[model samples]
Target: MGQRLGVDVIYTGPSTADASEQVRILEDMISRGVSAIAVAPNDAAAVTPVLIKARNAGIAVLDWDTPADESVVDYSVQQVDSTVYARHMYDLLVQNMGESGDYAVVTGGLSAENLNIWIDEGLEYAKVKYPGLTLVTQRIPSDEKQQLAYQKTLDLLKAYPNLKGILGYSTPAPIGVAQAVQEKGLQSRIAVVGVALPTDSGPYLEDGSLDVATLWDPGKLGALTVYVASELLNGRAIADGQDVPGVGRITVRGKVIVMGPPSDFTKENYKDYTF
Candidate 1:
């Protein structure tokens, strides 16, 4: 999208998903006088001060994937509607759990704004929509690591013998949950569902450990983010329900542009997606 727009795009990020690294990178970008900046923040709060600095410098700053302070960024882009995505995960869990049962949640990080939005939305929706479903404990934080998620799942298994479902809020969280379920041979007993990459989730999907892995196409999401940034840079307003190349229609509400809903990658179709 950047190439098509004839805009110079230089992609750089933290070597690890660390908030301090992201702040340093943003400082470098601001110093370089970049025309526009879009970030999928690792920790929204940690980067807000830097983003405010960017805004003051007359550099267009936007949030993609994860949101920062609303006052800082020009506009925000979301790959999917948070409410819809969260409810969908809950619906998947209830459907696969054979009615409704005790379920737990695992998240990437407590500081991730996007993850919390989904988890909070799902919790609210569950109380009204599926009253029979019970959350066994408070949501566990995995630090966005598969190994940590794996160990957390193991501990949950030992603590709650009747854990019927697990809703993983991060990419690595679901894969790790599925791994523990597979190892325990509890596929039929526990329903594992969450957001994850199809490439990384294929084996779990093939087995019965992971009932459903849901997410939007990151390639399309990246293109949409770049397109949105380019449009903002050109003094063009992103109209609601605007048709975008490669990404279809986008819904714009206030300063937020939502791409669409998520895609559920299951054992039957995980092979079709390469990323």
Candidate 2:
């Protein structure tokens, strides 16, 4: 996508979700005088000042996936409305669980702003919409690691033997939970729903371990981010309902960009999406 737009997008960050490393990376980008910097902050507050520094250096600062402080950030390219998406996860959970039963949440961690938004919204939405649903414990942090999530799911099963549904909030969380369920032959006993890539979540979906995995295309998101940044750099407005190729049409809200709807990958449709 960056190549198509003639934009040299340099993708680099801390390998281990480190905030200090993120700051160091941005500082280097600032030193190199890059035209734009798109960050999915590991820590929004920890990364905000550096983003502001980039902005003051006459570089475009955009946040993708996770958001940065809105006051200084130029644009937030989001995949979908967090509230709606969160509720949709619960909706999937309810459908798979049949009657409401004990369920729990496994998240990437407490740091990411986007994860918090989804979890908070989902928890509140679940209380009102599915009154029969019961959350067994506080949302557990998986540290965005599949092995950790798998370990956590095992613990969840031990803690709540009657657990009927599991809502995984991170890309790896559901896969990890699904693995544990699959190994335990609990597919029929437990319904797992989570945010994961189609390619990564396909096997679990096929085996009925993961009931549904939901997410938007990262390829399209990257393209849209570069496209938006390019427009701003070239002094063009990002019009509402703008048709962004590969990402479909987008809706602009002030400094925010919504990249159409999210895709829910089930066993039947998982093969339809390549990325």
Candidate 3:
């Protein structure tokens, strides 16, 4: 999309999980005088000022995957509505766990606004729709690391032997949860579900450790981000239900662009996808 739009796309990210580094990178991008900037923030609050600076400099700022401060970015590109995605995840967990049991959430981190939104929505939906199900613990932070999530899941299992389900909000979290369940020989007793890359979760899905996973196409999201940035740069207004190439018709609400539907991957079809 960048090539088609005759724009140079410069992609960069922090080498580690440092929001300061991410801020530095964005500041550098701003210095480069780019036409636009698209980012998935590590720390939404910390990056807001830099994003605001970019916007002030006449750069189109777009948020994707996870949103930064709404006041800084022109719009956000989301995989799906947070409420809908959360309910879908919760429904899948409840279905696999026989609709009633103790469950816990494993998130990327407490600072991830998008993950927190999903967890909050899932909790709310569970309270109303699945009253028999109980959330046994508060959100467990995984730090977006598989090893940490594995250790955390182990601790949760040891703390609550009767834990029946785990809802993971990050890709690494679910895979780690599945590993812990498998290691404990609790696959038959516990169910794990989350947003995971099929390539990462395929083996677990096949072995019955991970019951299901859901995600949208990241490639399409990247292309769509560039397309939207180009549109904004060219002074084009984004209308609701506008058809975006590569991504289907999108819904514009406030400053957010709902990308499209998310797909569920199970053992039966996970093999068909590589990313």
Candidate 4:
């Protein structure tokens, strides 16, 4: 897609959520004469200087999925907001858990801003609305491991014997937590919810170990990001509530793109989704 748009995409491979690495990738991509760069920033603040340099070099820089620096970025595209998604996740968990019980949250990485935002939003939402719901623990797995999430859930269950629900921030986190609940023979008491791919979560849901997971249309997110980048490259001033071609209608609020609603997955409708 970058090549089709006359831009070369320099994939920096799978690196840690480190800012220096992000900067290095941007510098390398820019030095190669890439007219525009779309980045999924690992560290939001660490990559700011290099992104600033790329902007100064007349290269358009856009942040996709995660925003590095709103001031320096021409635009930031997201599939959904953390708070909105978190509220939805919390509501589902609370409703399933009878809206009052001990709960815990498992996260992908402590330093990943995007995941952290979702965790924060979910935690805050739970605290405000479900005052009786106590947070048993907040665990962030090393290397984004499902096994680690499982272990953390087990530990939380033992430490807080009243734990009734578990909320995860990413695809793997929830799946891992559900697997742990099943293994510990606590699935009957504990409910699991998070952002998980439907195919990967189908078995868990079928077994009644998981309740709800959120999914988004990646094709739509990618297409919209590409379209918005093209428009910004053409020197169009983006305003709030502008429509992008393939992504649907979007509104720009602050640094976020606000790409509309997220799709939910449950046992009743899980078969209808594949990704």
RMSD of each: 1.0, 1.0, 1.1, 2.4
Residue 89 lDDT in candidate 3:
92
Model 2, 202-240: lDDT tens per residue?
889998999999999888898899999998899999989
Model 3, span 43-125: residue lDDT tens? 89999999989989988899998988888888898878988998999989988997888999998878888999899988888
When sorted by lDDT, best at the front, the candidate numbers are 1, 2, 3, 4
Deviation (Å) of 167 in candidate 4: 0.5
Best by lDDT: 1
lDDT of 1 by residue, 91-155 (tens): 99888995577889999988899999999999999999999888999999998889999999999
Cα error, residue 45 of model 3, in Å, equals: 1.0
Candidate 4: residue 4 lDDT (0-100): 54
Task: Give the winner by lDDT: 2 or 3.
Answer: 2
In angstroms, the error of model 2 at 275 is: 1.6
- Runs in model 3 deviating more than 4 A are none
Q: Residues 1-275, candidate 4, lDDT per residue (tens digit)?
A: 45556643454534554567667767888888777787877677777788889889998888887666678887788878767876888888877887787887788767677787777777777777878888765555534677877788777778888788888876788888889888887778988888888888898888778888887877678777776777677777666787766667887876678788899888899899767
Q: How does candidate 4 fare on TM-score?
A: 0.88
**TM-score for candidate 2:** 0.97
